[model samples]
Target: MKDKYDVVVVGAGPAGSITAMYAARGGCSVLLMEKDRDIGMPVRCGEAVGKDGLNGVIEIRPEWIAATINRFRLVAPDGAVVEPDIGGTGYVLERRVFDYDLAMAAVEAGADVVTKAYVNGLWKESVNGQERIVGVTYTWKGIPRKVRGAVIVGADGVESRVGKWAGIDTTTDFRDMECCAQMTLAGVHMEENACEFHFGSRWAPQGYLWVFPKRHGMVNVGVGISGMAAKTRKPMYILEEFIKERFPRAGVLTTVAGGVPCVDTLREIVKNNVVLVGDAARQVNPVSGGGIAGAMQAGKIAGEVIAGAVASGDMAELEDYPRRWEKLRGARNRTYYRMKKAVFNLSDETLNSIASSVLKLPREKQTIWGVFRTALVKRPSLILEMARTFGLKERE
Candidate 1:
């Protein structure tokens, strides 16, 4: 749209939109681009986000929410159920409306927004014998256009090429990747205020299956399996079998498929004039594969950092983006990664045995804390990994 701007954000997802909003609020010309013709089209997420996860970042709007969850049940392979005291902490969102509203907020804050803009390459400017990311070349409406900027934020999804172009390693271990498939179905009988998660190798191989209520009779049923297992078992067939067994009468209204990077955050999120946020930075939770909240949080940090750098007339200030983010949540994220890797390595029978032990406890002991404590009793060596999961030192 313009020859140049102070900041050009690629991918107008939550991370990109939030980055644009904050950067513009901090006194910078920002342009947000989306490859899709409409923002939030073809929703690929399970759409369940916890209330505490989004507390300070975004005020929950009534319209953006489809269903509110008060509790959740964790079902083991033997059908042993453990209900966690979540206390109405989660909500299923209408992502199409939610994402559009987020981008609109960015526009209202003085950032330019464009859809159907596909970024094919980055614009590099060399200085002192080093090439730096300066801008991007994108196709808008079947026409090639070039836009230059002092800073570029790659808010693109998991298959992001921006970071790769900037020489940042965005590689993920296949075992750390979750191949996911989701379906929005109607005529399902389920607890309206509770989400259900089923676990076991039979249920989802190395991952899990979730049934999040969208409304009273509608639900988002999904499964996430390890990418390594996906090589042998097709995700769609697995999902179909699970659905048929659980909800034979359910009619599928919509189906979506995607991949979630269930690994620690990328070590380097910013390089020179370029920054990566959200999935591009692998900010999804290693344990749950949840990323909406983390993406927004990282976007907020990246926006402020980029804006501060622009105001200070120092390009080097962008390097602090990842540092500030890690200080805020990355440290805990790394811990989760460690725990995820350890638990993921556990045999399915081991997990089921652990679940059975927890289920035998009283209703009061069915909490996540209780489950972990029970697990520690069986495998004392996992204590350190569990400590790391909570950001606690092993010595403590």
Candidate 2:
């Protein structure tokens, strides 16, 4: 809207909105742009968020939630099952509403927010023999426009052209990408207050399948398969087949397909005067492929760091973005990456064995940590890393 601002954030998803909101609240001029006509149209997520994780970054609103979850059902190949208290609240969000509200929050915080504003490229200039991004070029409401800023934030999703333009390598390894497909179904019979996870080659080879309640009698059923596994079968086909077998009479209401970066945080997130956040920075949980909560947290950190840099007129302060992020989640995500590798190698029989063992315990003793501990029965050292990362004792 304006020709210039203190911060220009691309992709008005959770990360961009949060970054813009905080930066504006911190007294920096901020612009949040969304390429799509609607701020949160065509949702591309599982739409599930852990209570503590979401509340840590933003307040929870009942209107933005679809279902409240406090427990999880885990199903192994042999159909052995265990239901564990997720330890806190969980919510399947009405993402479109959630995203729109977040963007409005940014606007209320004094950031200019716009939709249908396609950012085509970055405005880069050379300084001291090195190129740096100073702003962005976009088509706002079908009119070509350019805006300048002291710092740029790329909250673009999996296909991050802004990061590419800023010379921040945003590519995820083929093997580390998860090809995902999800469909919201009506008239499905499942626990309304619980989320379910299914595992095995027959269900979701090289990845996991999830069933999350959206509303009473309605659920979002999805499957994420490793990029390697996708080479053999389509994720959507797998999902459809499972739906026919599991919820034969249910009606498909909506379908979504996308990729999730199942890798550790990028080695570099901030470069020069630009920083990458959310899916652009590969901030999703390496083990679960969940990015909503991580994106919010990363956005908050980036906003504060960029605001300080703007206040002092010292671009060098931008470097604190990555350092602060590392302290918050980067280190723990690396541990999750290793855990992903270890879990991926486990055989179907092994998973069933673990599930059986977990089921044998008293209902209350069959906890999420107990399941994690069973997976690391061989690599006890990795258990230490897991314990430290999760703030749980190894014995738990």
Candidate 3:
């Protein structure tokens, strides 16, 4: 690996790879490093990406998709189901293939890529008597090494040490941190190409349970419980119990356990010559817990901004990265965070009431806002938050 580059990005996930791709395309020497032995090994996500959002970041490839989801169901505590009148809007991805190709895209765009490189800390030096981040210290194959860069972008996961080292407040509130467990279950015979969200104390107390269909009959069954609720019973135990009750006959293929930081965007994402993207910057959608699109979007923005700043020799341009992110994606995440705060605290009875009310809507009125309206009826104070969250306008 080179000792120096114009842009040094840590992590080979969607955010880092995309950042390296765009930076290299913008005429910067970029290095994309992955801590894992291989990129996209041991997938951790629920693997659902919105159709338009994913397309906006990268051209959608058929091989990247595992299943086309055309239907969405919100299940209530009392077995009530509310179906939204949504068109084809989602896809469950084959992330193993998808992430590898994206990193390859970055390499094709002229970024150097490496694997099994673990970044330990940020290295800074005095420039004009002011300390500024200049590089990173990491180990490759157990050999210590450091790389210098004009800019360092941290695309690490939710527990981002780089961000913490850079002095960004990456701390998540106890309630905002979601403890999750997921399993790939086979021999399940429910609806195909349909994603279901199950809600209730029996499923996931403050968080929710999801059944996302994969390419085969295997379904991604998972449960996310709020940190507050996790204090009582662990997420894996809840998931195991739910599996026994819901899909008792299904065979378990794989299991994953992790934490998702559900906080909105950090107050600061860019500092000096150091930057944070993806989950490191808390870009995951609070309500849905999806981040592929948001990470790519942030990566692109950060890459362009850092490249422009380097090209112009004005480090001040780096600040534009966070502003653009806020305008393009962070504001939306903030709205979802507020919505999560409201919806996550609802009792099972309230959820059932909302679900029952939503199921009674006319076929034409069965939309996201339709369900929000039903929720607003029970909790009247959610009108403004709901309006902002759903982008609802004045009555026609």
164-227 per-residue lDDT for model 1 (tens digits)? 8888999888878899999999998778888899887887888889999987598989999999
Error of 2 at 73 (Å): 0.5
Per-residue lDDT over 254-345 for candidate 2, one digit per residue giving the tens place of the 0 to 100 score: 99999999999888898888889999999999898899999999999899889999999998998888998898889989888877876765
- Where model 2 places Cα greater than 4 Å from the true spot, the runs are 126-130, 141-143, 378-396
lDDT of 1 at 147: 92
Worst 10 residues of 2 by lDDT: 387-396
TM per candidate: 0.94, 0.93, 0.94
Clashes of 2: 0
lDDT, candidate 3, 44-101, per-residue tens: 8888888877766788899988888877888999999888745778899888899999
Local distance difference test values of all predictions, in order:
0.88, 0.88, 0.88
Candidate 3 has an lDDT of: 0.88
Clashing pairs in 3: none
